[model samples]
Target chain A: MSNGARNPNRWLAFSASIAVVALTAACSSGGTTASPDTGTGDGGSDGDVVLEFAQWWEPELPDGVLRGLMDEFEAENPGITVELLSGPYASTKEQVVAGAASGTMSDVVGLDGAWVSDFVQQGAIADLSALMDDAGYDQTQLASQVQLDGSTYMVPVVNFAYMLFSNDAMLADAGVDVPSTRSEFADAAAALTSGNTTGWILPLSLEAPNGIQNDVMSWVWASGGSMLDNGQPDVTNDDVKSAVEFIVDLDSAGVIAPGAATLKEQDKVEEFTNGRVGMMISSLAHINTIRESNPDLEFTISALPAADGYSGERGTPYASWGIGVAENSEHKAEAWKLIDFLMSESSNAQLADAANAFPGNTTARPEFVDNDPIFQEAFDVWQAGYPANEFVGLPVAEQLMRDFSEQLQRVLAGEISVDEALENAQAAWTDEF
Target chain B: MTATLTPEVEAADRQPTPPSSRVRLRRLWDRLTPFGFLSPTLILLIILMVTPIAMVVGYSLMDRVITAPESNFVGFENYVEVLTDPVFATAVKNTIYFAGVSVVAHFVLGMGFALMLNSPILSHRLKAVFRTIYILPWLFTIAIVAVLWRMLLSPNGIVNYLVTTFGFTESSVEWLSDPNLALHAVTFINIWSGYPFFMISLLAGLQGIPRDLYEAARIDRAGPIKQFLHVTLPQLKPIVISMALLDFIWTTQQFALIWMTTGGGPINRTEMVSTYTYKLAFATYDFSVASAAAVIVLVLSMVLAFFYVRHQKSRD
Candidate 1:
C-alpha cells in the first residue's frame, strides 16, 4: 500500500488506543457499584425483597448497634436483604439530595433532624402515620418527635442535647469555677485564657451550619431570644442583638481559640481532646469520641446558662437523627419493617448504648442512659430544651442558617457591629422568604 | 502503439483496467477510517459536554428544584434572582479577584521556574531533580492538597510554629480565619497547586525553541533580559496566552480546595461563584438559581475561549 493509505491506518490505531486508555482511566477512577440490584433484587423467589438504607452513621459506627439490628432483622425475615449506603457525614446530605434528583434514593434513609422538614417539603420522604399505626407504635409520642406539620415522617434513632463541655484541668489551673450565667461565663472564660491556650472554642466556621446554629443559638435562647418568633426569623430582636454583642465581646476579649472562626465541630473537639482548650460547647454524640481519644483528660459538663438578669429557665439545644422511608421507594413495606426493628425497645437500647447517644423513645431514654451520671444530668437539662434554632422549618433553611452564621462571624471579626449584623441577617431572611 | 494492436497488447496499452467499484469504495473507506475510529471520542464529548450545557440552559429557564417534581417556565426569572442576590455579587467579586491574582502569580512563578530549569549552566541531573520537586504538588489530588494546607496553616500548625519559633512573629496568624487574609490564603494555596502545570507546559514550550535564535541574540550582544524579551517571550506568547486563559477558568471554578480549607468563610470573604452555586443547589435545593449561575459561568468561560481562538486565528 502507498504511504497515504498506510498513514490513515496508523492514525486509526492511534485513536483507538487513546480511546481505550481514556475509558480505562475513567472506569478506574469512578465510584464502585455495589450490586446489580438497586432497590429490588433480581427476580428471585416470590417472597424475596431487598431494601437499600442510606445512613451517615455507618462510617462512625460501622459494627455498632445499627449493624447488629440489620443482622437480626434479616435473620427474622428470610429472603429479605438490606443494602447499606454510607459515606462521610459532610457528604451525606448532598448524596441524599443527588439520589433524590436521580430517583435512586434508598428505601429508607437516616436523615438529620434539621433536614427532615426540608425533605418532607420536597416530597423526598414519605408520611409514616399509617405505617406507625400498623406497627402498633404510639404515634402521639413518636410523632411529636419526628412529625412536621402534624404528619409523621421520621422515627427518631438518637436524641441528644447541645451543652457545654469543659476541660477540668484547664479551668482548675486558671482558678475559675463552672459558670452558670452569661456574665459569669464570660468572666470565667477570660480568667481561664492564658498564653498558648484559649479559654473557649466552638465551631464558629460558617461551613459547619449545624455547629454554628446550635452553638450561637444557645446564647440567643438563653438571653430570652428565640431564632424564630411565630416561625419567622427574629434576627432584629433586642435579645438577639444582645447575644450578638456578647459574642463579639468574647472575640474582642481574645478568649476564643485563635482560629475559632474557621473551626469545625471535629476541630473543636480535637482541641478539647488534646487538652489544650478550656471549654467547648458541643453535643453528647462526641462524648465517646473525646473520651476515646484522650483517656486521661479530665472534663466536666454543664447545662447551658442564661444571660445576666434573665429570669428564663435554663435550656439547651435538642437535636436528633432519625430514619424515614423515601416517598418513591419501591420497597416501602420492607423499609417500614426495618424502621420498626430499629425503633423497637431492644434495638433502641442496644443502639443507644453502643452509639453513646440517648434513645429517641421517651421510655427508652432512662434505660439507654442507664445509670450513667453524666447522661442523667444531661437528660434533666434536655427535658427543658427546644429546637436549636427556628430555621428548621423555614424556606431555604440551610442558606438562611448560613447567612445567620456569616453575619455572626462578621461581628466576631469586628468588621460589623451587632446591630448592623442583625439588620443584614434580617434583610437576607426577608429577601429569601 | 499503432503497431501493437493485438488484444493482450491493447490491454497493456490501455490504462490498467480501472478497479471495480468495490475496490474504489474500499480505498475511500481506508481514507475515512481514521475519523471512524475517532467517533467514540466525538460521541463522548457530545454526551458529556454538549448534553450538560444544553441541560443547564434548559434548567436555568425553569423553576425547578431537584427534590420536587414541580416545575414551570420561569424564563429568566432565575437569572434575575441570581444576579440580584447580594451574595451573588460577593461571589462574582471574589471569583474575579481570585482568578486575577492566581493566574498572574502562576504565570510569574511558573515562567521563573521554567527559565531556571531551562538554563544551560544547570546540570541535567540537578535540573531533572528540581523539575520533579516543582511538579510534585501538581501530582497530588486537590483534596489531599487542601487537607495538607489546612493542617499546615492552622493556628497551632507547623507554619505558625515555625514563624513563632523563629521569632518572625509574636503571635499566630489565623491564616484561614482572618477575614482579610482568608481569600488571599486560599489564592496562595491555589497558586501553589497550579503553578506547576504552567511550569511543565512552559518548560516544554521553552525546549521547543530553536537554539539558533538564542545564539543569534547572543551574537548580537543581547543581554539575558534582552534575549528573553526578544527571543524567548515572542516564542512563548501563544502558549502563555492559552494557558492563562485556561487557568482563569479553572481557578474561578475551584471548589474542593476552598471548600475544605476556608469554606468561603470568615464571613463569606472567599465566596467564589462555583461554591455559591453549589450551596444554592445542594444546601437550598434551588436548582434553577444554581443552574442560572452555572450558565453565567459557562458563558464567561466561552467568551474568553472564543476571544483566544479568534486571536490565534488572526495571528495564524
Candidate 2:
C-alpha cells in the first residue's frame, strides 16, 4: 500500500458525504410539523386572537377597507389579531388540500364551489348550517341556487355571474339594438362585426369554465329548454340542439372570429375594453377591469336575451371561493367567532370591495358601492340569479362541457360539422360520465 | 560515531510491530476508510435523490385526494389510466414530438453554426462574442422567453409586422392559437435556448480532435465534406448523443413556457404530460390520478435514461 495513496482522507470524504445526504433529506421532505402558524392566528402574546387569511396569486382586495373592518373587529374583541397571508394562487389549493387531508386545515379556507362536493365527499369540510343559524344569519336572504343532496354545502362569496356587458357606444356604432330576443341578438352581433371587431364574445373555446352550453343555456332557459330534464344531459334534445345550432350558425355567418377557439378569457375583455366588440357576454367581475381600461366609456349590463317563449331566462353562475371553518377545529369557538366577524356586514363590505363581487350576506350589498347607481344595478343582477346547478358539475363533466365547446368552435370555424361536433362531444362526455 | 547508531539510540528510534497485528490494522483501516470516503455522497444521494423517488412511488401507489390526509393503496391503476387516457396520450405524443424534433434540430444546426465560428478566418474574440450572445437565451427564464415570443408572435407582433410589411400576407397570423403552428413556435424557443450548449460542447469536441487528422485526410485527397464526415462527425458523436439525451429530457419535462404561452388550450394541442399532470394534480385536485400519471412519466423517463446509459456503455 502506497503511504499517500492509502489515505486517511477517505473517512473525511465519507463523513462529509453522509452529512450532505442527511441535510438534503431534511430539506426535501419539507419538514412537516403542523405548519399551524399559516395565517389563522397571530403567534405572539399580544392578547389578541391572531388569525391568518391566505390567498394565492395576489388576489388583491381593497386593503384599506379590509384593514378598517379587521381593525374594528380587533377593537371589539380586545385581544384578537387578524392577519392576512398571501400565498401563491395556484398552490393555495395544494396547501389547503394537503392541510385538510392531514386534518390540519386552516381555521378558514377558501374552497371553490366547483369542488366543494368532492371536498364534502372526501370529508374535508364542516357543515355550516348550525353556524349560520347560530350567527342569526337570514337564510332567506341567500340566493336560491346550488342544491347539494338537498342541502347547501357552502354559502356564496364574491361571485361572477355571466351577464352581457357591452360598450353601449359600440352597440350604437354597429347599428344594433340592445337585443331584446335571441334571434335579434344574433342579427345584432352579425350587423356589428367588422374586420377589427367580433360581433359577440360568447365563449368559443371549451376550456373557458364559462361553458358554451351556458351561452346556449341563456337561450334554452330563455327559450323554454331544460338543461337537465332531471339529472340527464338534455343536450340531445331539440331545444338544446337548436340553441347550439344557432350559436354555430352565428360563427359560420362570420359573427365570431375564425380563431375564436383559442381565445382566452382575457381576450373578450380586451375586445370590450378596446371597443372592438359590439355586445359581449361576460361576468360582472370584469366590470372594474374594463372600466379601468376605458374609464370614460359607457357600458351597460343586461340579462341574456330572452328566447321567444320564456318570460325570464338569465345566465346562471356558480359561486367561487367561499370561506368555511374546519369541522374538527381546535379553535372551534375561536373559529366561529372569526367566521362571524367575516360574515358581518362590515367584512362583507370589505370582501365586496376587495373581490369586486356580490356579497354573501344581504345587508352587505348597500355597503358595496357607497350607494352608487352601478352597485344598485349589480344588486339587481344578483337578485335575478340562480345558483349554478351542482349535479352537472362533476369536475369531469365540466371538462367534457369544455371539450364540447371546442367541438362547437370547430363547427363554427368550418373545421367540422355541427352534427359531427355534437356527436364527438357526446362521445367524449359518455366516455367520461 | 560513524553511520551506525548505538543500540540504545536504535532501540529509541523505533519498535518493530507484530506483522499479523499490522496486517489486521491495515485491513480494518481499509474497510473503515472506504465507508468514510463514500458515506457523504451516499448519504446525499439517499437523502436527496432516492428518498424523493421513494416518496413519489409511495404517493403513486395510494388513493390520494387533494384535500385528504390519509391515503390508501391503489396499484397499477395509475399506469393503466395514464396509458389509456386521451389527454395523457396526447401529452405523451406532443412531448415526444417536441423532444424528437428539437433535439435533431439542435444537433444539426448547432454543430453547423459552431463549425462556422470555429474557422480560423474568424477572429477568436469575435467568435467568443458570438458564442456568448448565442448562449444568452439559455440564461433567460422560460417565462421571459414565453412572454417575449408572445409579443413577437402575436397577431399584431413585430415578427408579423415585419412579414406584413414585406408583403407576406394581408393579415397577421394567430400563431399560438393555430394548433399547426403553436408547437412549432414552442419548438423554436426551445431550439434557441438549447442549441448554444450543443454548439459549445461540439466545438470543444472539435478542438480536441488533432489537426493532423485533417492533414491526414487532406493527404488522402479528402474534400471538406469527406473530412467532416470521417474526422469531425466520429469525434462529435459522444457530444451529440449526450446533448440530444439532455435536450430530450429537458424538453419532455418543459412546462413553464407552454403553460405561460397557452394553458394547453385550443383543444389541448400543446398539452405535454408534465403540464397535463400539473393540471390534474394542482388544478383538478385529483392527486391520485396525477400521481399515477406522474409515475408513468417517471417510468418513461427512466426507460429513456436506461437506453441512453446502455448506448453509452455499448459505445464504450
User: lDDT, candidate 2, residue B54?
Assistant: 73
C-alpha lDDT of all candidate models, in order = 0.78, 0.67
The fraction of correct interface contacts reproduced by each prediction comes to 0.49, 0.18
TM-score against truth, every candidate: 0.87, 0.82
lDDT of 2 by residue, B164-271 (tens): 889998877767777677777778877877787788888888889899999999999999999999999998888788678757766787777777676676667788
Identify the runs in model 1 with alpha carbons over 4 angstroms from their true place. Answer: A1-47, A62-64, A140-144, A222-225, A309-313, A365-368, A371-373, A383-389, B1-39, B165-169, B308-316
DockQ of each: 0.29, 0.20
Error of model 2, residue B70, in angstroms: 6.9
TM-score (second chain) of model 2: 0.88
Predicted model with the maximum DockQ: 1
